[model samples]
Target: MNKIVAIMAGSVWKVLVQPGDLVEEGRDVIILESMKMEIPITADFSGTVKEVKVNEGDFVNEEELLIEME
Candidate 1:
């Protein structure tokens, strides 16, 4: 299984990919708002998204699972 996680604690500003979306390495999956700035979270491996584990405006802690893919 492949997964994407939050790199820092922040509110989700955007979810760029959805379940069943084909993702490439280095694609931004989530954009988090922390300290008034948007931080994009990227995928390190190519995969198909299997689950969306968070919603826009949801707060996530550092290392929190954001998406599941395989």
Candidate 2:
């Protein structure tokens, strides 16, 4: 499994993919809000989305796992 982790502490602003969805490397999967700014999280590798570990509005710490892919 490949993990997509948060780059900074923030609240999940949006989830752009669901489990079973096909994704390409560098595709934006989640958007996070921090310091009143929006940050996008991208897939690290092309694969099927195995799981989304965080939900919208959920707060996450830097380096926290946000999504899994396989």
Candidate 3:
């Protein structure tokens, strides 16, 4: 089974992958900017990205689903 990991921080600056992209565990999927710092949201499991729930420069809240993998 696969899981979805959201951006834990509320700052979505860049989306690194698109739907149908193959992802590995610990790979950076999104880059977030908070307080002028960059943070990376990584994949929790090895799977293919099924969907991208957020886009580049989209403001997201904590625990907001950014990508779905399976």
Task: State which candidate has the highest TM-score.
Answer: 1
lDDT of 3 by residue, 28-47 (tens): 99998888889898888899
Please list all clashing residue pairs in model 2, or write none if there are none. none
**Model 3 residue 43 distance off true place after TM-score fit, in angstroms:** 0.5
Error of 2 at 69 (Å): 0.5
Model 1 CA RMSD to the hidden true structure, in angstroms: 0.5
The weakest ten consecutive residues by lDDT in model 3 span 1-10
| Local lDDT at 62 for model 1 | 96
For all candidates in order, the CA lDDT equals 0.95, 0.95, 0.81
* Best of the two (1, 3) by TM-score: 1
In model 2, state the lDDT of residue 11.
Answer: 99
lDDT of 2 by residue, 10-61 (tens): 9999999999999999899999999999999988799999999999999999
Off by over 4 Å in 1: none
Residue 19 in model 1: shift from native, Å? Answer: 0.6
